[model samples]
Target chain A: MILDSIQRVLSTNELVTAFLFVGTLVWLSYLISARLTRGQVHGSAIAIALGLVLAWYGGLVTGGNRGLADISFFAGVGTLGGAMFRDFAIVATAFGADIKALKQAGFVGAVSIVIGVFVSFLIGGIVAISFGYTDPIAVTTIGAGAATYIVGPVTGTALGAGSDVIALSVAAGLTKSVLVMIGTPFIAPKIGLNNPHSALIYGGLMGTTSGVAGGLAATDPKLVPYGAMTATFYTGVGCLLAPSVLYLGVRALL
Target chain B: MVIYGVALLSFCMLTGVLVGDLLGEVMGVQSNVGGVGIAMLLLLVLSNLDSRKLKLTPITEKGIGFWSAMYIPIVVAMAARQNVFSALSGGWMAIVAGVAAVAASFALIPVLARFGKGEHQ
Candidate 1:
């Protein structure tokens, strides 16, 4: 009787159910990572890994378009994870940020973002070209993906690039994200990655908000705000430059 | 008191959305522009206002901190839901681009760190 009522409620309120399911999964993942990894792997990284496994499983089980959408109760995961809530979290986190530290990052911070985007685009473009995908639009869109995942799709859509190319760009960004998350803590000591100014510079250079945020949270929670500040700017700049100057320039060259 | 702080947070969030929407319109993006970034900047400004006009309580800070910490796991879950299957279907090009990009980014971390250390005093 109780199970039937619970299912009824879950069906009636899909978004809430989705949140509950995700929350439970994240909690369990955190426990496993903490216990099994002995804190060597960050819980956020573990949670993300679990999420991917579950998504792949969901796809195989349901043959649905979305990863978790095969199950009627979890279909709302798509909406919950969309830009709206994504933006909401981004905005909300801003409240705790220390703007003074962000300002202190100064000229190096700005320079890092410029160099980061340019270098990432160059690397991505080279890979795309070498992969036998030489179309200028494909190259540019994929290059923007290297800058950041958000830039990948925005640039792809703006340039009217193919779905395959856009999807590839996203994959590139995700790979970058996972790498940054896993690598940040190990490298933190070597990079002298303490303090807010350095955090901002690291954020600008990394250019993956999820990666930077997760990595910083693991290394030092206090640094999340500063890193997120410049990382956020990196995304905006990437979106602006990728679709226009970057595309036109690539088009001219190739 | 906690309720009052929650109310303050909601107000800041709403103001952020409003301003972000306007900024997006001006930029021709027709929406939140950088979405969370814009809202965060707005919140940053609002967060500062506590000293002069708002005088938000410690609980408000606690409230904001709680939400800020929530971003990572949520982002992880969201990103997994969004992108897991793409590479699966997109073929070798996607996989190769992803692997190569990661390798390249890793190689450049030291170069990026050098720039930051140059500014160190």
Candidate 2:
């Protein structure tokens, strides 16, 4: 029965697997969060556990071929979402912040994600067309998971075209993760961008841009700590709802 | 404070999931757990926050608002691929879902904000 269940799960498409991974993460996150809330666990433990699980599950899902990239992409998305949500919370709760601010932030974050995804799609399409590629024009959902987790792989998948998009996305996500880790802190300080919230946004944009850039330069591992948190949070939210939401949106338009 | 943050987040998520599930069961609506979690968290956080600082520069506020609106269309456009409106029996159902999501966020924020305040008093 156990073996059967494992097979059933593995045989399913990437979306179902993505959902299962997220659901598990959410549940684990809740457990960790609960422990922290009860003063039973340190925040560092939570962070470590998150990183470890991310690495492990990411490897498991993407396998040896694209595991690192997939892990990085998903982690990036989650970190971005979490950071945005955290900012919204902080703004909403801060003595000087208000409903308008909260509303505005939420709006901005959501819109940014939409714009980002659309832009990525447009770029992917143009690249495919200019190169005389014959892949499906529709945004590939398989890579979306990797893209949400690891931006590089998604970008790779986008530019790599058709059959190898998954592999390309995975490769890209890993490379981007490394770059963002190295660059965000240094760039942030130089650019006068500070604070955890801003750091999160900066990290996300870096991850996104790195995915666009592919494996150009070596990324720093230190930024991984910061970017991982935000990426996981956003990726979690997006992965969970993207399919249902996308389905609804497309149906309405057609 | 960290413990409290974790506990509150957990409670909000659990409550949101439960509430969303109950509502889904009763109404046959397909509300998302994450959305509920977000709404609940917002409510809890906002309620405990001081009301005086709810301000931002107009430009910043506008930027945020625009981003928030941007997600809706992407989600809607993607959802359209699934024939979501037809499943709802009409476009009105989709509108209703959108309205409910927005309303839930707005209503819960203030109500939760008040509840958090009452606890302190």
For this target, which candidate reaches the highest DockQ against the unseen true structure? Answer: 1
User: What tens-digit string does per-residue lDDT give for candidate 2 at A1-254?
Assistant: 99887766544443444434444554564577576567344322333234333444445555532222244324322332232333332222222223343342343334334433333333433333334434442233322322333432333343343544443333323322332322333343344333323323332323232221111111222222232222323433333333444424433543
Q: Per-residue alpha-carbon lDDT of model 1 for A29-94, expressed as tens digits?
A: 789878999877767667666666676677677766467656677767776765555555656666
What is the C-alpha local distance difference test score of candidate 1? 0.71
Deviating ranges (above 4 Å) for candidate 2: A1-101, A125-132, A137-147, A150-164, A190-192, A195-254, B1-6, B15-40, B43-121
Residue B53 local lDDT, model 2 = 63
Alpha-carbon local distance difference test for all models = 0.71, 0.34
lDDT of 2 at A113: 40
lDDT of 2 at B30: 32
Q: B1-121, model 1: which lDDT tens digit per residue?
A: 6666545556666675576567656765422444445556667786677465676678767766666666765665564464456545556666566556555655555666566566655
